[model samples]
Target: MNGIRAFGATPSDLALDPFDEGTSSYSKAKDTSPIARLQERIDRGETKLSHDAQFGYLLSLMEELGVSTHSQLLVFSKTSLQRERITPKTPRALYFNDDVYLGFIPGAPFIEVSGMDSKLGGVFYSIDQGKTGRPRFVRTDQCLECHTSTKTLGVPGPLVRSFITDADGVVDMASGTSLVNHRTPLSERWGGWYVTGTHGAQTHRGNLSGREAFALHEKEPNHLGNQMDLRRFFDVSRYPAATSDIVALMTLEHQAHMQNFLTRLNQDSTSALRQFGHLNMKK
Candidate 1:
């Protein structure tokens, strides 16, 4: 797993394992990510993870990850590993803390997680909800397909996108999309997400469903904006939270880019310092 994690899909990608001896080895180093630490505790018999009848490891995982249930954001776009399971009727729920992010779909077998390492940019894993007695987080690189691209500033990092989504929860890629962040305009954010709040007359692309509704948005911007309830679109009772807080969504947008920039800084500085030291040693 360590060796596989060291190498990325493309040659131009940085060797996360620390190619030169001078730099710290990210894969081989003391992995201090939240999930990794929790795994260590489990291995040492210090603690155990629990499961639930309905939410599976969701409740337990959030406790272990130290994220608030209040931080949940609901995204309905077909933009995840379980695309078939996600629709406007069943939007995927996302929760994040400063360093960790947990993604869940109701009744799904596993909970997707992305966490930050003090050194390694982002680590991806999934906890099997079915494993009752001894659930373990299994690391996977499948997330790198989208996470390590230009959107993440060429490093393994967070991804937040807003785009036009039709009724079936399909994102219209050709219509253009914004990789959301603090710089994102109010009008362009939360296209595929369910934002439940009253933002006064400040219009956004949230809560509007179907092509017709979107067409209406082009004419009347706030027609579907400032939605305080989501029961009409889907059974809000089915999700962890009845409402997706606009403040939480806004915070997520800012932090996503911040995490990417922080990761890029960590990578670049480490490499540069290592090379400088290497050159000095030869002198």
Candidate 2:
């Protein structure tokens, strides 16, 4: 049984391996604004790259709100021995702790905020049947109250949580050690307690429940590696893309990244100065 590790609070702590190393620049702008100060550090190799965990978190949040899909293209086998079939997979939610693309762009700021037209902002579709439509946006201020807490608070809400399964027919998390190990036999493999089987994967042994696995982590809050319960800020009940609501969620995320970057910069500067003065005295 290849046990799954839970998602880490920090980017360096993801379960899935890192993405391919050499992709072209995704952003196309220069950084001449105040945010450029951070960009210079990145260019000079003074800062580390942000982790995929951030992007994954954003993708998951989008999916929960019905913003993105698993598979954009359907795969079909055309061999004579096999009948035609289509398989689809969607991407996980994505989050960002910094303005990563600014490094490659000559003058882009560390934080870029483009105003997306309201009409194109929130969009959703029915996972049940690929039905297309829009959902109403109700501001979830109550949800953000806890999610936006600082790290020292011990409950900095997560941006995403991808689910997986374990050997005992239990749903395990990649970020933590929570398990939704129900004993119904048939229903044991259901995802997120929905029993929809949409989020389960069938392995050599049995079906691995993705949603159940995620729920397990949520259930075990204090589990050694468990960080925060992401379900708190997500209003899954609203279907089809909760555009306005999701926009607000992303906005908060943007602020969070700015805060994180400033904190790190301060620490790095202090350490650098301390080391530099020490070297001078030694000489």
Candidate 3:
């Protein structure tokens, strides 16, 4: 099989831009939020934490198989996010599709599969090689098929019912109060609920309407305002990858998936051959 390097004559030969929306910020204050924090981490660092020795080992195996880069892999997690923390029990690595990668549009929620666990948090992915385009949100229904079914893994799936907590950290589903007891309406809890009004009587205008609503929502006392706008949150032009690091990252990710596929095939063949031998003896 041809390696990515083979497909492209040289790394510099690849036609790509390095300016990733995920890495740049127009408003430094906006980028200080939790979602942006996580994005920064994911963009600049490796996925494994120091405590994740086993996960690191797995990453090594992946790297050996050519799954070491950023473009080829899409990460998903079955955990909710908070303004400060992410608790993930079922983190999955999948292949990136064109739609999923570049789907973060101007009006979308910047939803991220990795951040689905928390109402306050969202996820976004960059599709354009340089991360110049908008980041799109991942919808709740889109995740329900695999996340809602415990039969597949026996763990609680992705679908979760969350309520705002009061200052005492008491969840008041009736009033939509959160740990701070800000008296936030249930209608505005998660981005999805806030956008769709599934949790409360309030109906959020999709995209364009949402933007108009956000301007109004920001004026309300105690509202943190909508922090999901990439343009408002990031400086889209200045990133370390602005020099073609994104292309490199995507190239690396693609190589990793290819290697993983080949590795899986080899393992399958070995298993099949063993099965055949066992059947012959039994016969």
Candidate number of the best lDDT: 1
lDDT of 1 by residue, 1-283 (tens): 1212222333235343332233544445555788888899889998877777778888878887799989999999888887888889989999999999999989777889988886777888888867567788888878777877667766677898887888988988875455777888888888889998889888888877688998898898888788888898898777677888999999988998888777666666666665575876888
Model 3 RMSD, rounded to 1 decimal = 20.5
85 Cα displacement, candidate 3 (Å): 6.7
Off by over 4 Å in 1: 1-30, 278-283
Top model by TM-score, which number?
1
- Candidate number with the higher lDDT (1 or 2): 1
Deviation from native of the Cα of residue 266 in model 3, angstroms: 1.8
TM-score (C-alpha, index-matched) for candidate 3: 0.20
Query: Which order, best to worst by lDDT?
Result: 1, 3, 2
Q: Candidate 3 residues 1-283, lDDT tens each?
A: 1123223132223232111221221112132323344445545663322212222222222232233333322111112332212111111223222212221111222223322112111133222222222222223333333322221111112222224332222233453212111122333433212111121323321111123434554465224333232233223232111111223323433433333233233333444555565776877
lDDT of each: 0.79, 0.24, 0.27
Residue-by-residue lDDT tens digits, candidate 2, 1-283: 0212222234333222111111111122232322243335545676433322213122322333233332111111111011111101111112222221100011111111111111111111111111113211222223323222333111212222113443222323342212211112322222211111121222111112344533554565222121122223233222222121222223433443433334333333444555565777888
Q: List residue ranges in candidate 2 displaced over 4 A.
A: 1-10, 13-172, 175-244, 278-283
